[model samples]
Target: MNSFFSQPTLQLAQSLIGMELVHESKEGITSGIIVETEAYMGPEDRAAHSYGGRRTKRTEVMFDQPGSIYMYFIYGMHVCFNIVSGPPGKPEAVLIRALEPVSGIALMEKRRYSSWKRSPAQARKIMHLTSGPGKLCQAMGLGLELYGSKMNKGPVFLKENKKIPASMIEAGPRINVHYAGEAAEYPWRFWLRGSPYVSKS
Candidate 1:
């Protein structure tokens, strides 16, 4: 399982598909098969937070060893989870974009909607329970508190689920990265082909 992170960032992003990302908490255990991911290569990729080798307190974890968790806050309200895919000093990561929930659906739905009123207009469906980055974190109980932690440590970790055929995977431009200029066109985002849980970009 540890050797899995040794792959290149682009490969890691695609390889993550079909693997089960699990989080065990007091609430219960919630797990999902990774269906979509986006790779961010730093220093050169303008879409990356570590572009030009910029390292601040928020991005410090990106420089850590491979498999280190590099979670961050986004839009001042949502938490996004990234897995460091590094060669020790390099700042590259794979953002977990979406997941297909396979365990604790009831709990996930509860965690996802219990916090606020379920607006009828939202039309929240089980397929959308963990369809996006922020939604997955909220459903799985992931937060900034787990920042910088190793993937195999604590209550959250990945379990090998099944192997995804290469033909069943596809790549495209990352979502919400138009500000990256030319980098926005890079086909760094990977997803399971025909997966309904993939984020709608």
Candidate 2:
């Protein structure tokens, strides 16, 4: 499991673009093809939670072995899922941004937008379901409970899949990290080109 994430953070982020993220629970097995990811370059990256080599209860798993989960809350809500990468003590991670739903989509819809009184338009619902980090986490039922878990075991696991072609891959500055200063402009985000499931264009 840790070996799967032994690559540098940037390389792992790009390599994960075509893999399948599978979550199995009593509800059902909800799986999706990973289409978007963003890399945080350990302590030196201002956008990273472990920037400045800070250590805390929340970030301890990030300093553990590669392939560890590093989930955290934001804005007092929304759990974002990240995969710990790079070498131990380095604290780098790749944020899984978006997923193309592959199975159990109805379960995802039930988890995500079931509270709405009126059903949303079919096309819009599919696009909005797992199209963002928070949205995908909510849809796939990822939470703090999975934090520090290894990737290869149990409830959530990434399955190997066909590789995406370089021609279909794109990279750009990460989203919503303006406070990272110059690091905010670094092109560390990678995604599958022409994929509607990507968080943003």
Local distance difference test, per candidate? 0.92, 0.91
TM-score of candidate 2 to 2 decimals? 0.94
Q: List the residue pairs that clash in candidate 1.
A: none
lDDT of 2 by residue, 10-110 (tens): 88999899999999978999999999999998789999999999899988998999899999999887999999998888989999999999989999988
Off by over 4 Å in 1: 118-123
Tens digits of per-residue lDDT, candidate 1, 1-201, equal: 777897999999988999999999999999999999999998899999999999999989999989999889999899999999979889999999999999999999889887765565575788889999999999999989999999887888899887999999999999999999999999999999999999985
Model 2 spans > 4 angstroms off = 117-124
